[model samples]
Target chain A: MKGRLLPLYVVALYAFLHLPLLILCAFSFNSSRFTVWEGFSLVWYRMMWNDGALAEATWNSLLIAAVSTVLSTIVGTLCAYGLWKKNSKLLSGSLYLSLVTPEIITGIALLATFQWAFRYLQIQLGMHTVILAHVAFSIAYVVLVVMARLRTADPALEEAALDLGATEWQAFRLVTLPMLKPGIAAAALLAFTVSFDDYVITSLVAGVDSETLPMMLYAMARRGANPVVSAISTVIFVGLGMLIVASERLQKA
Target chain B: MKRLRALFLLPAWAFTLLLFLGPMLIIVAYSFQSKGIYGGVVEPWTLENYTRLFDPLYGVILLRSFVMAGAATAGCIVLAFPLALYIARSGTRKSLLLNLVMLPFWTSFLVRTYAWMFLLRDTGLLNSALLALGLIAEPLPLLYNDWAVIVGLIYGYLPFAVLPLYSNLERLDKSLFEAAADLGAKPWEAILHVILPLTAPGMRAAGVLVFIPCLGAYLTPDLLGGGKSMMIGNLVQNQFTSARDWPFGSALSLALMAIVMLLLWALLRRDGEELL
Candidate 1:
């Protein structure tokens, strides 16, 4: 009886976890906007497709995520290599601050800095500022992932490459870079997702023209139940879900 | 060789120093300054912003945030401990179970929170299903309250609690339990004496992870609590956005950071080597 009850408990917990998401997905198909179902239809999905502001927000989000991911992955990979070679405890410890600091605090700090700088440089708060904020936080994750990968990697492989008449740069390019590919990929994916999904920081730093998908979703949700939110959410859910699955497979490979 | 390595580190360290550390310093400075009559900051620093935090209204908000966060952390611990233990003990299907726990974790946070709004709203599926089953006479008021906010917080943070606990539990030596049994200790006694003490670090880490985020949570309370329940995060957000009080916001942000830093310092003191 105890053994059977254990599985039942686990099953109930999983049900609790997944039921809300499944319900949201299911209701997105309801023709009626209310929770009470009318007939199944794609009207909400079509409405999301026709939302011009949302489309712009989605584009901005993709742009910021893409830029921040690339920049952070490169800088962070180098930083990881530097930390591994240098073993700088202070530098490594400081990275944890970004991870632990609350998002609201981080957002305001960045906003204050940007406003301070813009006073001198005359630059406006827009996509550039948003990308900068994303990269600032994202580098922490990338460094962490890469550093973990570096720890298990055999340092002697690079030494061997150096002994074989390869330049230091060549050795890294030929040996370390190849080995770190999975970590870099994982880091890039993580940075992208984080930048893409961020709301609080983005909302605070984003100007009128630089709205992202999360910002749009917040505004819509704040107004009331819009079936378009359900439609857009389903799309994001499926897309990111696939990305995570693919990344997991890649890590295993 | 050392110089070359330093060159590689320059870009990242410089970026962090200029952007991350630089902004944080500005926030500290802002917290000291006086709020301008027309938004933003003014010269001639004062402690007024920090002092303003002691006002009864703000005091209540801070207290409420801590209570909510504490409750959520406790709830997560209760829900996550059993599940973590089950997965740790399970054979062959461990990865699958872990993945199941993580799938929703990786989904968009805003999207998941919005899903809860749909589920707990008065006319939501939960109420309708119960009504259809003749289990209720009318729709229940499930959303726009403290319970809704707590549910959302737990749902969002459960995986964070689970992951740390699972990692710690999975690493425990099975022989320890067997040894306790050999000594004629009961199962509950073994759990209390051996397992709980051993897993305390994981529990602490989980609590910190869930509690810190819950304390700073804005979206959950704003959306689920229908803007009625004001947490510290919402207060800071309002000070900057709608309240147009930058110095006050900076002070609040600093206060929030101080609490987080204190917790982190405690964590570091307890588990000095593992956090990094």
Candidate 2:
């Protein structure tokens, strides 16, 4: 029973999990507009290449993600630093507070404040605001990941630098930063990916003109079921798959 | 020197307060206010928002979301436990396969969700396959309903449940199982007396990790519900976009958070950690 049931269970679980995604991949290549498998074609790929809205949205998404990643990384690294040096109760509690809060709560709270409190603050509710929201949430996640790395990190290396007459800034730049590179890289990748994928937070914060790919995709999805969504899904899967593979290799190295 | 440390932390602290806590404080305050005629929070305290939310129409939807979220969490635990055990048994190969499992998580959640409609809709992938197999005369009603939501929740959260259980199971003491067997305990007893107790914390962690998020999920239901009903997340969404009632939305959100806290307290009463 053990031997017979084991692979049966694993295969069954993963099949049930991924069967939908596989359909999405297969249907993306289907030539006919209908979802049923038609003669295969690369027309969707060609269309994606020429689509101006998608082209512009792609650039906007990349810019938002990059900006959020860098900003979140710096703030996160310092927050991780303060939390590390003291491990004080207040810092630790607040850190865990944001980490555990539901994304919806955070999203709505920020939305109400942005559209209400800061409504007259004169900041345009566009790319700038979306990036700010992304960075806020992304910083929490990045801090958590980097803090875990910092926990097992030997501080002696930094101390050694200080012992050799390196200033605090010099010690961090040369010694701590190098050792923290893998952790920082992982944090950046995570921050970027999440910022890229986010819909709820961005939707509430993004201006009418500053549409991320996800918001656009969400509109297409909710308005009606379209096979074009499948094509978009396939492209994202391939793109993110490459990123994941690349990151995993980098992390291992 | 301490002030210097504070300087490094200033940016995050300020943003989290302004963006995170400040808005949350607004939500908390709004929850107690009256809804304006024009669909915003009125500048006065009233229990109208909270009372309005509990009306039967909204209550039914809340009940539906709870039932669905509970079913999803239970299903995920059942599916993930054995899978985690098998992966734990695989030793070195476990990490690589596990990495494969987490690969989709790096992709956009929107795409993964839409992927479900591709497989679950009538005349979609699974139905077509079933018809081809000559097993069913018709396609299954798999999409835009409870089952679709369940599938999405499990698919989205399964990796979370699996990774925790695998680590907990891997850390189990083999000697205890050996001793149980030596005492003539059957396989079932070995699992119950030795394995289950040892790894119960994994279940607790897995359950909380999946349940709390599932409770607030909007997209899965909105995309898959097909107007079957509204959920807590959907209610909040509608409050902003359609209802235009921010005060009521805030009230509903606060109640949802309270429900989450109550559930956490209830779950912690059965601390799986102490099971060992």
- Each candidate's DockQ: 0.72, 0.64
Over A128-165, each residue of candidate 2 has an lDDT whose tens digit, in order, gives: 88998998888887887788678777888878988999
Candidate 2: give the clashing pairs: none
Model number with the top TM-score: 1
**Model no. 1, DockQ:** 0.72
| Superposed model 1: Cα runs more than 4 Å off | B133-138, B182-186, B274-276
**Please, what is the TM-score per model?**
0.96, 0.93
lDDT of 2 at B261: 67
